[model samples]
Target: MVDAAQKEQLIFVTQKSLRMNRKKHFSESRCLQLFAEILTVDSGLKPAFLFDYCLSNAEQIQEYVQELQQTGLLSENLHILSMQENVLIINLNRIIQHLERALQENGVQVIDVSVHRENPQLAETWVTKQVRAQVDIIWKHLKSQVIQTGESKPGLVTASEIFSSEWNLCTMFGFLLGFPASYWFDFNTSFENCLSMTPLRAFSVSAFCPRITKNLKHRMYSFSVPDILYLDLQSAIKTWQRELQSDFQTQTMFSHLCVSTESVCLSAVML
Candidate 1:
């Protein structure tokens, strides 16, 4: 019963709604308003009619919107609109387009750094490269000591040292690697100290990183390490074995600790 020309028009309208979804900011109310506009124009129907149509197909529309929201591609406003409407008939074209344009203008990098951690070798290479680059730069500018070690894992490296000057190179490197802003713990706060920081313990840092969440949702590679260190190699192996018994194999949290083993050294790269 649908004419080709009318179908094309519907497609165009849908595309427009998607475009808008991309361009706008995080306002739930605004999304509802835009959705209202798209339905009117795309379907040549009144809001009441469109509302009814949506009501009839509520479940499908809700699933679609939820998928978009999980990706961080959906505006929070759209979500609010869905709640108010009691049905999910917002114009997909307008919402998506808006979101796309806004993201472009802001130069927001929505990359999944977690994917880099997928292949143990690749992950190690990336971590080593990042650490080395950071260490090199700090060494050139400051009088600091760096100690680096390679884990048995192919590409993983861990480096730590005290800089002579009060330069926060470790924090900078962590930030550059797209680690959570909270990963930069204070020098005074040891891993043990963080255990008692109840609020910090309550949530995973990856929860705050949108890119990481998106990657995880999409089945891309991610990384996680426990908050506490195993006392020895046997303990570490046992922990890994026990963890693998779970439905989800990956650890959800990671803690980077700088232990004081010895005194100052110049520069080192682990991997």
Candidate 2:
């Protein structure tokens, strides 16, 4: 039906069209894979839709559809429509309205309506004000109780004791790391006081017993101890002994004062 030259031209044209179609199909397949990867990392309708819109505009739909068909990756359940004159128009207004309704129903209030533009300083100020208001309410309740009672309740004493115990441990650790003898002496006094208290006695004993045993084992292994920088080992031991003696004196004074003053107060109250 055609001449030899015409036949050759027809075959060349057909091959070129096929090559172009294949290249376009590969590009679409790659774009779809990228879209899937993005969806895997972040799951949200707005983000997904934004990504899909971008891909659709960047790559032609015919090629994408052909790739989807070839790979059997087309989801029949998903209602994907081609952007044509016959199809419904999708505008930013409709998308925004839908997002607003959905977010509102889900109890998500959009404080900043602007997209991709936010004032960090204003946001920080707003957050700080909210936090301060909450803190003010807590302080108000505390102040009201303080005013009514004229003194904090006895429960605060337990909190103070816990705080002092932790502070003593920190000071002890610092003293072990080349602090002056005076600082170690102060920490030793606090530590001894903590050990004497009923609630804290068990913890102090547990901690100190393990530490002493560990140090003794290390000294036995090495047959020597590290040189003391601020205070000699002998001086440190003497300081600990002095703290113990001072604790005993404090206990004796407290007992005598309580026996004398408490009885006198009771007698006066009875009278």
Candidate 3:
């Protein structure tokens, strides 16, 4: 439940939200910061999962909200989609207040809402300023944490490796800090590439995808090839999406699903 201090910010949620809502101000990382601060403000609340369209389960989100609205858990007028441009904001304070009163009447104790209200302007200021700054700080540190390589390394580094290294860093950070990354860089989601979007990644699949497929298909016969499949960006992204909300597993081989793990795994199998 949300606190009573945030009602003024509800001004942002309007009839305009009845149409398609485009969420411009809050990205996933930004939402993470907002939720994290809320957690800080009230120590008792824990975030479960927040659904947004940018997430992989776009279809599931649609159905879940429809269910909630149909069951009267949510309003039919509620803005269901976060379009990253026009969006609806909820009045957390009032909603919690109503819920608390209803529950108390039914003898179900609820989380204590803070009677002391704070300036809602402060939340606005924090969202506009600090959230971006915090994301920058995290992104900067992640850039540094990547495992460095030299000219002596095997293949010439592709742009994907350089980019996904940050993803790897974020993966490690979330594992260490007990939080998962909410939004990822947009490029990772693309089925195409900067090289004119010529289906270049899929084309590359013909290069090494076969051997790995062969190994997996025939591994039962102990006739596996001694090669590894550096899952292209597409496959890696699909894997990451499936595991998006999962706890970071320290023992999971190639948790980031980048090429380096493919290299290591093949080398180890050969050895």
Which structure is stronger by TM-score: 2 or 3?
Answer: 2
Q: Write the per-residue lDDT of candidate 1 for residues 226-262, one digit (tens) a residue.
A: 2222122234333322432231223222112111122
State residue 186's C-alpha deviation in candidate 3, in Å. Answer: 19
**Alpha carbon lDDT at 170, candidate 2:** 25
lDDT of 3 by residue, 152-236 (tens): 2322111111222323232222211212111111234432212221111111010111211221111000111112122322343
Ranking by TM-score: 2, 3, 1
Best by TM-score: 2
TM-score of each: 0.16, 0.20, 0.17
**Candidate 2: 10-residue stretch with minimal lDDT:** 200-209
Ten-residue stretch with the least lDDT total in model 3:
217-226
The whole-model lDDT of each prediction reads 0.28, 0.24, 0.24
Model 1 bad stretches (over 4 Å): 1-170, 188-192, 197-271
Model 1 worst lDDT window (10 residues): 197-206
| Pairs in steric clash, model 2 | none
The candidate that wins on lDDT is: 1
RMSD of 3: 24.3
